[model samples]
Target: MTTNTILFDLDGTLLEMQTEPFVKSYLVEVGRHIGDKYDTEKLLKLIWDATKAMIVNQDADKTNEQVFIEYFTANSEWEREEVWPLFDSFYRDVFPTLSHLTYPSPWAKKIVETAKAQGYRVAVATNPVFPREAIFHRLAWIGMSADDFELVTVYEESHFTKPNPGYFAEICQKLGVQPTECIMIGNHMQEDMVASTLGMKTYLVTNWMEDRGEPQYPVDQRGSLEELYQALTERTGVFAQA
Candidate 1:
């Protein structure tokens, strides 16, 4: 299929970062900000566990936010009334400070802009484990706005996370495109490349690849972000059809 749509992963794909350290800082900082009456360690653990719950969630009706908040408040001393403000304030205030841990790719903005200029549809298909506010914050680091892409997936509006075919399917349905008519571009071997199961073409970004020592993944193409930028601009290799 000649794909007209492209899916870009945010974390290590577009916004460069060491995933483990960034996640640690993200959870620890949130704990520090909201652990006034709660145990800091326990609060971090609660967030970590609830995050996993959100990632594996498959409820079509309940958003990931519903699953995360329900699981988080149920296991902790916090009530719904107490949950909203603490987390909301943390995202608004503390989350943006963590941008220092990430290095934005100059090619990321260029690639999306080039794709738009060429009339190819684009979407930020990052794993919706974070709220839209946090996702937008990261997009800002990459010099992108939500208006730049046809769809931007976020926890509040998404039902599934990456590596689950449902997540890719949900995006396809929303964009009114077939899975075969889209390209999944990301750095994670299993999580991002899993979009291939839904018949989407896959591009593995190896510069900051996160394979977790798993068996080799068979993707349609593999390269760095700069190579991807060139592919979009010159219309070569896997992007030749575009």
Candidate 2:
């Protein structure tokens, strides 16, 4: 059987991120650059608020950028342009340095190449929470590149984020494939595994899985990327071609 697409999540799925350390380092670095202008706790709260708004935002009238900007302006009068440098300086410098908190999973890179060699369309369906540049840097840390994926969800380009069926729908429509023709592999049970509702096959990368209360959907569990590789071929019958 030919599986036309495989959608992978970044962050904890492809890249191993120790949540506390990464966030701590991130807040520290960004705080160092912009803290004096804004209260550190309040700034963090604003970011969380914007993220929550993004999760519940289903309005057809607004993009994520618009939602975030609207929420940002309402919460703090900071100019949008002023915040741009934080992303530029932080992701390029401080973020990369935080790589010490993460490591390349050779298994993850190998799986992508193996799937592509087997004629499956590969995509990084990472939540569109971060900018493309940030995603690109994370991919680089794992010895992958933006060019490795047929589709990569970036905030500016995507209207919907994960856990929302619309996010998966957008990728299907863009790739010209039905949801059933794609498989979503990620570590978040709530966010990534929810793709099954749209009929996409689901796999749990449990290396860094989060306990999301309880699962509302069924998924195949694989402990590591290496196991995922074998499981995908076995379950999809991709190996039968051999």
Top-scoring candidate (TM-score): 1
TM-score list, all predictions:
0.95, 0.90
Q: Report how far residue 105 has shifted in candidate 2, in Å.
A: 1.7
Clashes per prediction? 0, 0
- Model 1 C-alpha lDDT per residue in residues 10-110, reported as the tens digit of each score: 89998888799999888778878887767778778888899899888878898898999889878988677876788889999999999999988798888
Q: Model 1, which residues run further than 4 Å from truth?
A: none
User: Model 2 over residues 112-178: C-alpha lDDT tens digits?
Assistant: 8888877889999988877677788889999999899998888777878878899899899889999
* Best prediction by lDDT: 1
How big is the positional error of residue 200 in model 1, measured in Å on the Cα after superposition? 0.7
